[model samples]
Target: MTSAAPVATESGVPLRKPRIGLLGIMQALYDHMIPGITERQSGYAREIADRLADVADWTVGRPVKDRTDAEEVMREFVNADLDGVMVVLLTYGPAMRVARLFNENRLPVLLANIQPEPQVTAAWDMADMTYNQGIHGAQDTANAMVRADRSFEVITDDWRAPEFAERVDRWARSARAITAWKSLKVGIFGYAMNDMGDIRVDENALLRALGPEISFVAPGDLYRGSLEVPGAEVDALIAWENARFEVDPDLTAAEREDHARMQLAIEKILVERGYRAYSTHFDAIGEDGRFRRLPLAAASSLMAKGYGYGAEGDALAAAMVYAGHQLIGEGHFTEMYAMDFPSDSILMSHMGEGNWRVARDDEPVRLIHRELGIGRLEAPPTFLFRYRPGPATLACLVSLGGERFRLVVAEGEVLDAAPLPQLEMPYGQFRPDSGVRACMDGWLAAGGPHHQVLNVGRHAEDWRVFCRSSGIEFVQV
Candidate 1:
């Protein structure tokens, strides 16, 4: 099952580009340090900050010289709400003070072990050598963080190196994504599909490990809200879908309106609750019979508008989708639907609900009947389309007991799902870079869950950095 065209919903989450702030700090002794050499060292620190501006949105803070100055700089960072802080050490200074400040504030730290000069020149003198030397300072800072049991990253290279700037930008992106996750709200409607142990998560453990808060939404709220939606609103949604997609004539007008009403009600519920993502069990929602319509349209539409939607009450997957979307720009909620050994590919899909934004632009989704009642003629409307083929990554964030989670990721190439006459659902065909048999065996060995978030680009590196920065286990499949 799929969904209708995207709508301009008022409650949609606002997408913001990640911003990274830079801080330059030097450890200088008031009386012992050479004044002229320290001044040149600070100049080098400023240059590093200036170069970083070409890669990311950064604010270079005033260089700190002591513990008191470090605390003050951290205060400024908090006030500015910087995503991550890059500490550029000018000389061997107070590593313990910087580590304490970063730990207390719980900010992601990137230690810039950047040297002022790419290499030692023949004309270099004592002052020039000392000014360019920051390696020991970075080492000291890293040692301090490790002793404090804090997580941090190190980047050591010349400031002028393109690779150096790129690495900094990637860290910035990961940090920004982590910052966004602190206040994530995931709403769970209905119950988890019965007997899916892998999808079941300990709520307290999840909250303690990741900052996202989960809440339950009653089915009655959605059912009543859908019924109360004005006919004009539903008609407007249908008209919007009609203009954008090629709706199959087989679907009755009432079916389309039914989907529209459900979609609008869900949007209102999530918006009113300030939820950025949601999970639901279609079976449980309709079990009472008053609301038999599965929220296929709701799930797909919400995903397109930057909201994560997980089928079968998989709240973890929902949050994972949102995180990937923030870090990767676009992520589709999917599962291993089937294996096509002959084609050396895996058919990935779900019962319904996928990010339509990831669908192929060349092939628009078709309105299809979701015949879930076995032999019933009455069914809801859903979308069916092939996802855009390209390089992609599949990831699953699985729980590993109290306050522990592991990220399972695999890199692959996304291929177009062939249009077989019997295939009626939206899907993306993926060929794992590791080959089908090896990927399948490794995935099963790792106990990867049935559900995952598929992203358009290869983000295994980003995810690895993110997991490390966030203090989660990362297991590559």
Candidate 2:
């Protein structure tokens, strides 16, 4: 089956900046109203808002003193569709009112219980006492949220503290990612590979649990679109390929044109449908409906252009790739190709669908034609190269049957090794922190799928935060 339909533009994963609603709160204590306490609190609120502006698109709401004021600002946040909210306690505020609004939105929140001064000194006056009244107000807010049955991450420290800023920044990043997830769209152009139960995914479950829209495409639609692409577009793609790749003498012009058309067709689908990630299976594109022309080159090219691409209709792998890229900047589709005990490493690769952007820049990806043994059709061209050597991590989201799912993660080093001449696909050698055998055991223990997302840096921490934010089980092996 095939029907047609796309991350940020760059060689790295682009950050989805969060639009945060910033609110400062205080209770109306008319009896204990201290002069300049409100003004000082307002100034502190401005400072917090300015700090947040460094990491997020923040809108500072007027310091709310009562339910009427809180409701007005809450309405603005709702209308703006904020990814998350940050509530700063200027003084002991009415937690019931604030908690109610937060619970209704059901978005992630940072309950910042920050004091302007790191410490109180002998010279401290009533104004200082009034300004720092937020000290115990944090407990009030926490109690209110607990009563309202709402969850929030708390930072109870001075804004000037390095740790406070770091924690807040991390929360903002996590919120921005959640925003991206809600609007994500993934395209599955064919059915899952047969009999590979481990890699099979339930589209509905994925959509409900992870908040991405899934689109099923028919193969014929893509093929027809490819044929309709203008010859000029194909010619431009060929020219670009010749300039970018180490063209193989064995790759015929006709083969290159066909591959280019496939790339263009896929690109059109992604652009039109707003898909950020996609998957394809050879069996659905074959000549006799068993396999069609190999789309290895097209897949590789798309991956280099910042689109997540997975082979054999691996929607999970593609989505993970997209997520990893969004979180870091670069992600490659890979599998546990083979274990090389002799070198205490594991080899990772797919059928010529590696991201060329992750390959060694000095050694451009080589274009080559290969008979991938999938169909009886003519061999297709593929980009042949290995990923660049660097510290990396592998991440996989596996369905543990029913609606349960778990994330499997492992940190590793991309070792420098000679590519196997016999293997036509792009390959990389990796040495896990736990060694090859132990890593394999861990993978098996976690029930890790063969297909996963590989990225260029240690992203286990980020993945852990994401899993927590999304309520997914995490098994870091």
Candidate 3:
């Protein structure tokens, strides 16, 4: 079985390479009238396919000249698990040859409005027309797709241009993200935090809108799993943590072992059950004496391993964080705790968890034990660090109503600042592109929720493409 982990960069940004089908279209009548036209067009199709192979896992088909050829190519694409289809109009083929196939199929379509020649001069003749008239065919197919209400994008440019390849890459990534969203599975360890209206969602409505299947995990399962964790596993985890983090002297060896046990148990259950993301509620941790302390450290460690986490049972936030990680690479669940007018920044922090992998390289992540003020539990070991300073994007997914959702996004910068030792949690300061005040006002107007996924990159355009492909309302601040 393939591991569920995404392909990421050194800094942990996910690059979702998509699988697509590339089919070239041409008119059979022209092939008979001009003996070499089909061969020349096929060569262009081959070159374009080769150029795009690095961006996607492309299954290239021979040039389609008639209805029979179109049907055969369509069958191949339908049989395979493809994210989308890339249709190249080599010359003017009838729209009916492939328009109905696209209308009936569910995969997203990208129309390549390109020709063999980049320019048409006084030297242009009938022979050149037979090979370089694909633009009209692209327009014909695009019109039919629009009439049929199909989701398609047209790229009209020289195939060798950088922008053309970039657009194709963007569409491929967006299509892959859409596929990932449709099959996402999130384990809900506890119910949503009470009275948190913004974080609560209707499961059925959420499934219909975003396609994440929710599964409730009983507390007894975690309890059993924790007890079953071997002593060697716990010891290895503690040693790993000690080697990677600045361990606090105040934390006892027993406390470290207990934290490692909880982390191991969480990892085992999530991996065994194939969960992409999860949420935890402090109130549910020790309710039945199943846990000695809250498993606060697991959240950070799992996130570093590419699992999404949301605190206080915010499953919507969890799903968004997972998607952000898969779409961009570094995703941390956070809330805007305070506004600093002097610096025009918002203090972003979470309760006790973050993707520790995104911590600034200048400082080591500190492992410290902290008490839960609300629960009758022992102090839990968690990581404390500041996010790396860089360009960032804040994204929140919220329900608008039944079967409807919206994605609110803001482009910002994580300011370069010293870590606040007083705040014993993962934290960072973010300054929005439009300044803090204007951004906050716009965010509120768009119904942006408190819990959000903070990622280290300028990925607002990526989010926009994802939202467009997934049928979600996108509001940018």
Query: Where does candidate 1 stray beyond 4 Å?
Result: 1-6, 9-14, 30-50, 374-378
List candidate 3 stretches off by more than 4 Å.
Answer: 1-16, 65-72
TM-score for all models, in order of appearance: 0.92, 0.89, 0.91
lDDT of 1 by residue, 163-261 (tens): 988888778878877887777889888777889888888887787777777788888888888887877778778887787777888888778877888
Candidate 3's clash total is 2
lDDT of 2 by residue, 94-130 (tens): 6776666765756667788887888989999877777
Query: Number of clashing residue pairs in every model?
Result: 1, 16, 2
- State the lDDT at 269 in candidate 3: 75
TM-score between model 3 and native: 0.91
Top candidate (lDDT)? 3
lDDT of 1 at 447: 72
Backbone clash tally (model 2): 16
Candidate 1 local distance difference test against the native = 0.78
lDDT for position 41 in model 1 = 63
In candidate 3, what are the lDDT values of residues 296-365, reduced to their tens digit? 8788888877788888788888888888777777678889999999989999997788888778889989
